[model samples]
Target: MGPDTRARATSESPAGREQGQEYDASPYLPRRGGLAALRRASADCRGCPLFQDATQTVFGTGSPTARLFLVGEQPGDQEDRQGEPFVGPAGRLLRRALAEAGLGDEEVYVTNAVKHFKFTTAPRGKRRIHKAPSLREMSACRPWLAAELRLVSPRLVVVLGGTAGKALLGNSFRVGEERGILRPMPSLEEGEGEGGGLLLATVHPSAVLRADDREAAFRGLVADLSVAASALD
Candidate 1:
């Protein structure tokens, strides 16, 4: 095959996503008001194919004036059904860790990098299983996130898991190498100072559930979050 053809066949989009599908969230964002309006408008977001199967648009929740902004990969089964981010098993653990780390939900705003729950069903039970969102979807849904950041204007941003890290820090970002250390937030093309929040990369609370040594993983996640708390001082 020729170079251009091979490039198209073998490679992916700017986010290194295979370009499986495309949906845009911008059209729904422009006329929206602040957080509440955005939340309402997101109900109809057809930004990508993910919304096709998800129960509802799981949007960000918390105080708009929050100092700490936390972003996970996306909604899980419970979250999709509840129409709120971080409201599942992972969310419970996250709340516990945040409390232990000296952060509280009142002072924090939580969201997902991709707002929808992407999943596949198991044959036996027809159970929904979590699936990682592609880079294209992340890219597509980013405008909503951008609007969120603009309105919230948080002091710190904590990116949970590799998906969120990749969505913000680029595809090559590794949470293992960068977790706990504060880095400048990557520009979302929102504005000059819009992405200026101190960023902390860490594993999602779900990681603790999947870890062979749950204690170790939980400790590591808490430790990273503690650093974010420290940034508030």
Candidate 2:
């Protein structure tokens, strides 16, 4: 296995985490419409400390008018390097499953719950490990997420893993328990539209790729993606 693959398996912590530090909100966040507005709004989003250690905030990419919206946690190392969300090995898995579900990359907008990459540094090396962002950070970054949701306004929103599900749906949502279930989302806010968007929970692609039981995890992920397809109706 490659060094990256090994790290993917064993390392699961952000490089620099300081929960005590409060993130400052963007005072004059951009209000323009479309993806450009999102880019501008994310520019000064000091909503969390994850932005500090990350190279740059990798925003969501793909078609804005897509019928489906896929939400992940945050950027991985490759994503950080590319300054685009979900462009790594996990992303490839996501793309494959999406295709299998009769969805094209152009048919959905993909993003994350947390906007920035959160990681921890290894004691001996410069490597920054990935860590799950706390609920606090997720909440802090919620505005940006809301903005994206406001624009994309996808008919179906798929929470790709527990993190995305917990942040968008609720904390009690067990991804394992709820995987493949298409549940009507509770009203998020006024701008989120009437009755809110449909929500589905599934395991993150990284989990599938890094698991000891790769086959099981991958199959489970595929099953969840197929559910996403069914949810589109």
Q: Who wins the lDDT comparison? A: 1
How much is the lDDT of residue 180 in candidate 2? 85
* Candidate 1 ranges beyond 4 A from true positions: 1-22, 190-194
**Residue 126 in candidate 1, Cα distance off native in Å:** 2.2
Window of ten residues with lowest summed lDDT in model 2: 8-17
Best by TM-score: 1
Candidate lDDT scores, in order, read 0.84, 0.76
Instruction: Please give the lDDT score at residue 181 for candidate 2.
Output: 85
Model 1 TM: 0.88
RMSD of 1: 7.6
Cα lDDT tens digits, model 2, 1-233, are: 35564344223223223435544334324756678877766755556556656777778877878888889998898998888899999999888877876665437888998878898888998888899988888877766777778787788888888889887876787888988888786555645544466888888999888899998888788878888777675
